[model samples]
Target: TISYDCDTYGNPIEAYYAETFTPKVALYDGDTFIKYIDSNFVVWEDLRRIDYSYGLNLKTAGCNRKPDNNWDSLAKILNPLTYWTNVYSKDCYSGAYSLSSSESSLPFPIMNSSNVNGLSWRGSEDGHYFFTLLVIDPDFSYCTLKTQFSVSITGVPLLVSTQFLIVLSTTLAFILVLAATYFFHPSKRKIKPL
Candidate 1:
């Protein structure tokens, strides 16, 4: 009988075993416990078992149009045995902007390896973007996980000179006054000099 505690670091746990032997596996959450066993009674010479936990946490820095070389710091893998394979990103609204190494297309240069080293956005517009990370376990081909995160890019504010503002305000005021006089004021009749 193997006993395992689920309160370790608050990560989800998964157990895998070879199909050679039928073993009773029990899951306990809080005070409730559930038990299940394989219906087939088969015995084999080789049997293997493994237990692991999996989770992901992601964070991004301030909204800016630049490359962040600290991509590894921004993402945290709860499982140490797993490593990321690919990182993908696309615009949140139009999906016109996309970046990935597999696609061999990127707006800006990014470190594309087993780990996310860096990321950059050279979009023409400022908006929200989504990133998807693919994690996989080398020992288990079937074990793969995908996590997503979002980032916002804020472009620099458009600048307007003080003189331009003053001129625009004056022009608008004059136009308003002319409109009021033509629409609201009563017309006056003038006599011609003979």
Candidate 2:
């Protein structure tokens, strides 16, 4: 979250306390701060490595691009904060995952948009994901963001191999051939099941 994105009174447009209590991501266009949220809630605070010391630095360069960094950094470079902004590549094996928040992460960002106009992933990752956001107060003084909040993001599925696809195709082809032979063959033979 940034200074310009907050409402005049200081609450984010995505801050919903009625009906159901939930914090949401805010989207900005030009000078207008609008409320935008979906099934998955991502809280992104850009520390931007400016305060890099031990493990509290937030970098924007991207994770998988660099091999020297740890898996946590590489896997979550564009996460939580920017993931809701756009659709991202779901490749997690090579650890080359990336996402874009400015664009739609889902196929049609505009189609699945909420009232504030943001993209929503209908379990695009296949797994259920809960995120945590670390918020720090302004004036560089005391803070209450030490606690992490859970989000509504979904997780992705595991990677499968081409061999599996080949096997499945072969099995389906054999079944189709057997049915074709039974129905179209001249003798119309019937074989009993074992």
Candidate 3:
């Protein structure tokens, strides 16, 4: 269990004791884990869209282990949480920009919700984008949790469309016919002494 002691009058005899809970946070893409290019980077193809989601892997431990049907109510009453997302063009933690002033322009709109499910985003330009998912315990801001990740949007070669493929196949067949006729003509092939 999580125990906290508070002394208001600088006297041990008047100390207050209480129990608290801590929440967990994890980033997800629908039901699957987010695909990462590396430990902290993700790759997004040009013109491709992706949906982001998250999960709270809160386990029963400490002061969180409450009786059935009471855990949710108690947690909500005790730990009113807040969730938000941030996007950045550069790494603020590495001093590329100040954390307070480094928020980048969002390419797509994000819903204001705790779950973040069905939040769709499409990468239109090729660049490096950083994202953060933050959860704050309103009662104790110091207990906030955050997950940071980066996405690198890269350009992909254009694919030949169906029309292009048909045209290419017709041209190749015509060339093959010309080559066969020139190579296998009776006049071009000399007859051996039969």
Candidate 4:
């Protein structure tokens, strides 16, 4: 996602995507977490973790979900497009998501520190799979934002269409030829010692 700084009037003051999420909130920031500051200037770190209150579970026993101190996990859902954040943290002025496979472990940065956004998954036969990401802090009160994406998977052998007969026939023919050649090769025997 891109970044841009805005003035008090909410105008674009600067724009760039470095290797981290800007602690200072901006006019149009593309991140998941939204930070808020109260009258006392105590950046109210009211970030939410995964919404596992429901009957949803994230990791298994051996593998536990990681948590971030800068940002907090707001919600967890089944989405294939993007990985979701399971934990969030705060650091005085700013905060971010904790994208970890286990407690306290963080994934490497592919784009920037803010790159860690959220956790998501797709319905798989083996059950389900998803990755966790970290989200940058934000202004949640006046600024409400959400990141969304989609994914599509195909080629389930059990769900093959009847029209796949053409391809199957070609594959079978090729395999038959290979088997015939291997078993009935002309080099069945070589010249014996004189």
Candidate 5:
């Protein structure tokens, strides 16, 4: 439904909606402008949100920290022109949700990344925006690999718990098997040859 294209600097270039032939959203990532997206696309626009929400309003402190203001001041406090740019420069993977080398899935090389360049709002109560970038190989089996970026409030580390679950389950199963083998022998007793 939604498709996206990003440059090496991590700025969104083109966004396409499924229903139409032309791209509904066009992002301009220049010094004069940071993020200019078209919200008219139907389905593709919806998919773009999956990544767009990240750059919407991620705030951090120190450099562009603004206190005594709400999210309304986000654009002023942070450079809306380079706001999304900051979100895509991180090297941490927080919300990739699924990153694998399988053909059925997108082949993303860069798992997750975060950026130190952030902005702050709400009296700096909320930190800057945290960004995660994913690099897909795009040659996987049944899936199309593509480059995508995710934006979130600064300091929100991407928690990966599924890998741990699988490891724990495997360990428990192995332990249980060992216990059963120790208590229940499969081999029958040999008869004495007179």
Candidate 6:
């Protein structure tokens, strides 16, 4: 590995070390849960430790589905992406519902801090999502490590879909019409005059 002492072009220097390093990356869930990561997938469970990420589904009980044609090839869907946030806090990751930016320069950064801050995931309401980590080289050049991961959440939706709303509205309207007709019918009127 080489280091530029003062600045990008300050003092060109080289150093050799006995330790060996392979280009690799790992996620830290603070031991509160387990995660699976590889060339094709990155999954974590029981990560409720990330408090704010509730709706995003870091640890869903039992939600799963097979990928469909709607999803592009895994390579295209997961690779070459980046995300960032200046408002990162303890539970912010779990609070995120979707990616806000599309630029590829802001990959998720792993820090020495207890929290691996600045990455957000799409909430489980939509199913599978694209996740990416930046593989930074000692020399500063980097590429994105990408994967497709799903969250299985047995939780129920806060609101039903549009189709459900439409059906329910129609049913209520029909019932209202029947009740109004029954009450207004001339044959059913009963009046007593003194």
lDDT of 1: 0.32
Q: State the lDDT of candidate 6 residue by residue for 1-194, as single tens digits.
A: 32222322223212112211111334535645343332222222212223212222222211132212211233234332321221111232343344323321222223312323322333433222222333322233233333222222223243467669888999999999999998887685578898
Best by lDDT: 2
Those runs of model 2 whose alpha carbons end farther than 4 Å from true positions after fitting are 1-125, 140-158, 162-194
Q: How close is candidate 3 to the true structure, as a TM-score?
A: 0.26
Query: Quick one: how many clashes does candidate 2 have?
Result: 10
Residues 1-194, candidate 5: write the lDDT tens digits. Answer: 22334342254322222111122223434456544232211111212222322112222211122222232244446643233222322323344333222321221112112322211222212122223322222222123222233222233332358668888899999999999998897768788999
Q: Which digits, one per residue and each the tens of the lDDT, describe model 1 over residues 1-194?
A: 23223242122222122111112323345568754322111111111111211111121211123232233333343222222322222212242334233322212212223222233333333434333333332332344433333334455233457558888999999999999999998868678899
Better of 5 and 6 by lDDT: 6
Q: Which lDDT tens digits does candidate 4 get at residues 1-194?
A: 32322221233222122122222322334555444322111111112222211111222211133333322232233231133322132222233433354543432122222323212222222121112222333433333223221112233233345448877998999999999999888885789998
What lDDT is obtained when candidate 3 is compared to the true structure? 0.32
TM-score of each: 0.25, 0.26, 0.26, 0.23, 0.24, 0.26
Candidate 1 similarity to native, TM-score = 0.25
Over 4 Å off in model 5, which ranges? 1-3, 6-164, 179-185, 191-194
User: Can you tell me which runs of candidate 3 are displaced by over 4 Å?
Assistant: 1-121, 124-129, 136-141, 151-188, 191-194
Better of 3 and 5 by TM-score: 3
Candidate 2, residues 1-194, lDDT tens digits: the string is 22332232243323111122234544445679765533322233243221111111112322233222232443356454333322332322256454335311222111112323322333323322223343322222233222233323323343466558888999999999999998888875688899
lDDT of 3 by residue, 1-194 (tens): 21222221111111111111111234456678753211122112222234321212112111122112232243234432221212221222232332111122212121123322222223333434344434423332334344444443345223458559888999999999999998887685577896
* lDDT for 129 (candidate 1): 36
lDDT of 1 at 82: 28
Q: Tell me the alpha-carbon RMSD of every candidate.
A: 21.3, 16.9, 21.9, 15.0, 18.9, 20.9
List where candidate 6 sits over 4 angstroms from the true fold. 1-113, 116-118, 121-125, 130-148, 152-171, 174-194
**Cα-based lDDT at residue 159, candidate 4:** 30
